[model samples]
Target: MLFLRSRVEYTKEQLFKIEQLRQLVQKSSELDVGTDDTFLTKFLHYTHWDSVKAYQAIHAYYDFKHKHPTWMAQHPIEYYRKLFYATHCRFVMPRTDKNGRVLVIFKTVDAFQQFPDYLQGLIEMDDLIFESLLMLPRVQQNGITVICDLQGTTRNFLRQFSPQFMKVVNDKNGVLPFTQRIVHIIQRGFLMHVTSSLFLPFMNKEFKERIFTHDGKHLSKLREMVGYESLPAEYGGPADNVLDTNLIFNHLSQSADYLEKLQHYKKRIV
Candidate 1:
């Protein structure tokens, strides 16, 4: 319901603050990280342009990568190719909202059941998508909105959104350098309520307030929240803008140089 905020404004003062944050990052031996304008600007934006807090955010970001080394490991491209073709589980909407915030949706079905190993692949895939979005100036400036579409998943499958698992997710999300403006859960029936209950206890107050839920049958509430024009066709939008996993996969495939650079950066993390 809170998707009406404006995109980040880059005033002259803000630009100066970004430069200060860049110098702080470059000078620190502990934080050997990217000092690109977009990277530093987003960190400053996330911390309200406070250089000290933004520096701490940079440390938190790398600290996460150091703790989860496997998530940052460079696997063969074929692994991702197979994962994409085998299970088209996640897709980032090609369009952004009125505020320039991109919408990332993860549909839940029996796709994972077919490939038991995809669970890990799914996590890695999400990391790739998240990192890819971070590279975009529009995404970095405005932030992102996520929709977990659970329409086709069984109640048994929904059981995985447990308190412990979501707590870990919450902890990890705390360190991300970008803003997550809103999170929408699309589902219906008793399991929807149960899943919501499971996730609420673990979320911090800010994130908890940013969440909104919608039943798959209704389009008006969702449309009012994020606008019908911003959503995919499956969610009662235009037929031409259908959700396509191949588009996202193709973008990542073509970004070999950038992905390689990201791998190189991850390797430098200690």
Candidate 2:
């Protein structure tokens, strides 16, 4: 239950912990981690300022990157340009919530079903979006909430995400530098319920608890949680406030240089 507090400034104790985490990073020859205050502080906050946990999380992060290089690859601007125009796959909301947490919406119905062959590509797209978001200090501190609209998608959509793959994705997400404050799955149908049940075992306890499901009939809870103003029109917000895929593409295009630098952080296999 280590919820992030609204401490814009680090406390004396946290400053000490940051240095401790820095020492841990410095001592480890295997961990190619950034020791800068901004970078290291992200891990400390993710683990509630526990230096040891932050160090371990950093290790896990780099290890996972080494294993899945495709997820870290920077795509050309044209690649994202085509992807954005072609599909309504994923988009981060244009605004942050009252808590300063960003909202990232995933259109499962459009994405999973439409592009079965591009599952890994979908994952790479997610990484790019998250990396872009995590670049913001406010987003890194407050974290983000995810609203996965699964209303139109069926059990078949779950087929592409097998137990093994679910486990890998879940594990990778757990050690991510950015924290996921909440995840609201809005859907209906007994099959969808069953599909959700199948993936629960792979989740860690903390993440499992953050999940909230809705039947799509009642979005009052969703509206209240993420704020009605923050949601797009598709999710019961103002019509004109719909997700701007073009804006996302533009942001990614601008972040091309920074994303390119991230590619060098992966462990080099001998």
Measured against the true structure, the TM-scores of the candidates, in listed sequence, are 0.85, 0.83
lDDT (CA) for every model shown? Answer: 0.73, 0.75
* Candidate 2: 10-residue stretch with minimal lDDT: 1-10
178-229: candidate 1 lDDT, tens digit per residue: 7666888888877766766777788899888988888888867777777778
Which regions of candidate 1 fall more than 4 Å away from where they truly are?
1-15, 71-73, 76-78, 155-163, 266-270
Pull out the clashing pairs in model 1: none
* Candidate with the greatest TM-score versus the true structure: 1
Tens-digit per-residue lDDT, 6-62, candidate 2: 345778998899999999988887876567776788888788888999988888888
